[model samples]
Target: MTEQRLRALVYGDVDLNLIDGSAIWAQSMVRALRAAGCRVTLVLKAPVRTGRLVDPLTELDGVLVRHPHAEGLVDGDAPMTVPQAHAVLGRVDGDHPHDLVVVRGRAIAAALAGDGAFRNRLWPYLTDVPQNLAGFTPEIHGDLRRIARAARTLLCQTEELRCFLEQTVPEACGKSVLFPPTVVVPPELADPAPRTANTPLRLVYTGKFALRWNTFEMTGLPTRLTNAGVPAELDMVGDKIHDERDDPDFADRMRRALESAPGVHWHGGHPREKAMAIAAGADIGLSWRAPELDASLELSTKVLEFGALGLPVLLNRTPMHETLLGEDYPLFAASEDDAVDALRRAAQNPDLYALAAARCRAAADGFTLERAAERLRAALAEVYPQPSVAVAGPPLKVVVCGHDLKFFTRLLQHLAALPGLDVRVDPWRTLSEHDEERSRELAAWADVVICEWCGPNALWYARHKKARQRLIVRLHRFELESGWPQKLDIDRVDQVVCVSPHYAALTAEATGWPTEKITVVPNWVDVAQLDRPKLPGARFHLGFIGAAPSRKRLDLAVDVVEELRRRDPRFTLFVKSKLPWEYWWIWKRPEERAHYEALFRRIAASPSLAEGVVFDGYGGDVAAWLRRVGFVLSTSDDESFHLAPAEGMASGAVPVVRNWPGADTIYDRRWIHRDAGEMADAIEVIVKGGRWDEERRIGQGQVRDGYGLPRVRDAWEEIVRGR
Candidate 1:
């Protein structure tokens, strides 16, 4: 890398020396640039005449030089006298001899307007202010147009912010880059005084409160925590908005609500430092950036600051937090009871809290001032590479196949993570029956196609198409074992990415496809946070998770329980199926229904072995239930990486799985049983040997180490980038 010094002129509402959003951005930006080995000069618009040479400049980590320029027209960093501002800009331009001129607002438009030489590489950092200001004046409109045309880069806070710019300033669409706000400095943090064994956990929330400041209604996490008596407090550090306080009708309603709330405190408007000071002593930090019409595109500095202070945060689930804290932090419920339960859970298990805190520290390491500077340096290098610059159009078009809402949504989320990829998914539902026009149009628009069509005729139609677009077809359980579709249809697919290598081989053998074209990308479940709760009593009970009637074979489960009952009547079955009645629904005719009903009625009525099976239907914590079950039995006839067995593996359950067509290989040894009789034998062996705990320990460790999302995401990134 070559050593290059870059000067930056930052004009915004808040001063870094002072406090607020603008300050955070400028301070962090300056620190980041300096760490990137660039000398930065921050230009601000405070009155220079009224005061003696007031040093508006404050150094951040000794890397950034903050200069407060005396701006006369607008007291704040807003549009001012065009030519006068230009004259000031010219003076700064001449004095600095900077490589890049950073313009944040219209106040410096004249300075940027005069000549192409000066305006050529203007990088304006927009903070979502352009869209919300009161009236749209001619000068404001003209200044925005000029900035859009003249600026080399428009650094936005979010994709939502970028999309807004695309719609409002159509011409500046290609130049926009999403850059969320970040912390410029690590706050002073200290470990809380050690609590007594019987002491309640201390939970704290510190931030602003108002219509735009806090999101009290949307996320009910705080409410849940308070109700559970987890010793929580929502500390409102800022004064409520004027409208909320002065308006009698609104103020009454607000006070009544706040007063009714038990564990919340309104500490009305403390100094920024004081608020942070109060936050430093808490065990758990609450950094929820309340959702606002304008702030959905916003990432708060609070969460980052909390992390820097070594406090594990319970954040609101937003795109901004999701991006920065990816697998580095934990999130909690937005309800009162949930928050309380979360605190209770944390208090009961210090290990979890400690792990979360460690992760928070790890996240802070990556989000430090130096790291941010590196990111800023890279962004600037991309925008102002060498001396020559040319704006490039959006790169690569990404077309996703299968328009089922869930699949497409997940696919879009993953694709969205990769920058510069234009993504669009064809709504597959409409084409499910047949629609030539829509299908061809979708194929025409896509540069690369991903289709899930299994029928041979459909693949043949796609094979004959004229387009040279690369095709990727994904196959899971339905396509692997279903007799409805023949294997010859797969020859039309260019490449196949299956959920499991076992299934891939099974499909290739069944379809008679060459092995080279098939790649196994195991069926991935988004187990983003799959850690199970510790329940000691979970060692005795046996369980099975899943609802498919024929595939799961509930009958086999009943038989296994009865057989186990013969050896030891204490062996209970905990069936974690979504629905018990759905087992009978699979039968079409009255005879089939009657047979299922008779068997179910007999099992329900029998006092001997039937009482041992308890059907605990759908639950929130499936993984936890898995922990509660000592032996996980999956007697399925067909499966594609059955989730129940996988979850069981995650939760330390000894998997008594059948040699189902697609899932037989998930076990450590060769599946010894293909039929229900064999499954009964396996269950009996597990119960008699009393080695379920050991099996569970080995299985959970294997899954946690190999099949978790981090490993899967790395695999996915490689596939997407063609690495």
Candidate 2:
């Protein structure tokens, strides 16, 4: 592949300064694309501000650079608006379709989605993901949905980020590919300098100096190593300083550390090559960051750079890092003390240093330019064969007729927007009835009729459905016991959808429905909408949806919280739901009122319970509301799907489920408890034993993979399309 071939593909990024990690990635990936046998239309976010940093990749083989000739509005000076960047994309790909167009930035991704030009060939390489609960707002959620809806594939920088993305935006679940950071090893560093005895153990850090980067703490390394009987020196090569917003003196302190700390040399800043040259001479790289950054799903590019130069990296022992360097890697550190011990041990032992270096080299092998090129090439090629086909034929006539389309709306919207499907909704007036005139009109018009609930609407469709029209009726928990399924004519319906396998089995047994006709499609949790990082001290906050209607067993959840607070008053329960009095039907019932009255009296009697139990009323922002909850309690008497636990799991909360009928089938056996006491036992063990975060991730993985909207949508689509 030569420079001529690069024109078939395009690469666009939002950053124009070409400095940060994202810029570094662009430089590396462009080279990988060149090697992958595709010439590219390199679209810059802004016009080249100077000749000094005009990316050399623009002049590479098979490359065409598109600079915004019309002076676009520059942000302050360097960055261009997303509109200008998008305009560049439009100009380059006008009418004539390219093989692929890779873009970046959430804003530009949104723009590309709205432009509707590169519908099928767009690959968005994303970074700067939301790190907190408040970040995944409704607007942000819509932006992600648009991106997912537009792109053929999404590229993530790390596996962890991809997992988070899937949970955050389920539509991107199967489409996302790992496009991890790549390293360009300098040829001059082909052979790493030997760390011989009597020579100072050189520790180098190359990046922006920041509190979270632990650059200030890095200055203390040389002296601490010297105190341990091994003389050391520190080299830092970055000019940018990230000041903590709340800490005005942080930069001053960092400057003092770099200037006055013993045996420390600082190179203000240099080009990538110049910086790598300094790092090449070092024996080890310093990347042990602060605890705050440990929660990040991104991989450290510094580690890859160091490893590319055959140097071991001293970094935090995060799961991603551990997987990269293994459990036995000598340089993994958790605290300042661990860092001192690890560095001292590596300095004293040549064998351990050599081992870490070798392991680091091996870990970095898969991230080289050659490997990345191969992966990128294959990903592009895979997409090329299955080109986006426009909605060609007559739209598949679909009518989703039901009273409660709450669960069906997400699927309906997807179907309505699909290329080949013409979808409509014929909502029933109530659970068992619809307007006779409108219902008759819809039934005749639809090629496919979906009765969302197996209620009266389904019963009517089962008898009246045309032989040619495909009728799909879904059975829920209430219908199985309400005699609706038994009343319907079984042979007319093409498919019977159940939310869970346990319910499907019960439906088959109790209603005598044919086993072969029923299929289980679990209720979806809008993972991306629900899943966000937990709030501060969420581990101590237990939560449940509501206490109303009695069967939900809100009192049992209070019991668990009361039990936990007995041992540790720090534990608290947040009830984010309407009370019995809020619902007239529930409040009017003498039995329901009595149950809540007794429960309130008990809570008022105990000081711990009074303080620990809090009723945080219903909020439309379920996604953000879940952030305050660490342990989601599901102590219901019985349920078909019990959506709360799944939503909680998606939101990075550990679930404590009562062993209601089929609860084990819906959730992992570990989360299901026999009683309130056992639920409290599980919560205490997960929290006190320091496995809450781990459990949180596991829960997210489970929900994201199994019950995410994409999975459920696919299952429903297959049945609807007769695939």
The numbered model that scores best in lDDT is 2
Candidate 1, residues 54-139, lDDT tens digits: the string is 23235244343333233342345443354545555566667656666665544554347546767646777765345443444767
- Give the root-mean-square deviation of each candidate in angstroms: 14.4, 7.9
Q: State the lDDT of candidate 2 residue by residue for 54-122, as single tens digits.
A: 457666867766665543423444555777667667766886667677876788888888877778667
Candidate 2: deviation at residue 219, Å? 9.5
CA lDDT of each prediction against the hidden true structure: 0.57, 0.80
In model 1, state the lDDT of residue 195. 37
- Give per-residue lDDT, candidate 1, residue 491: 51
State the lDDT at 104 in candidate 1.
55
Candidate 2 residue pairs in backbone clash = 3-61, 3-62, 4-62, 5-39, 6-39, 6-40, 7-39, 168-528
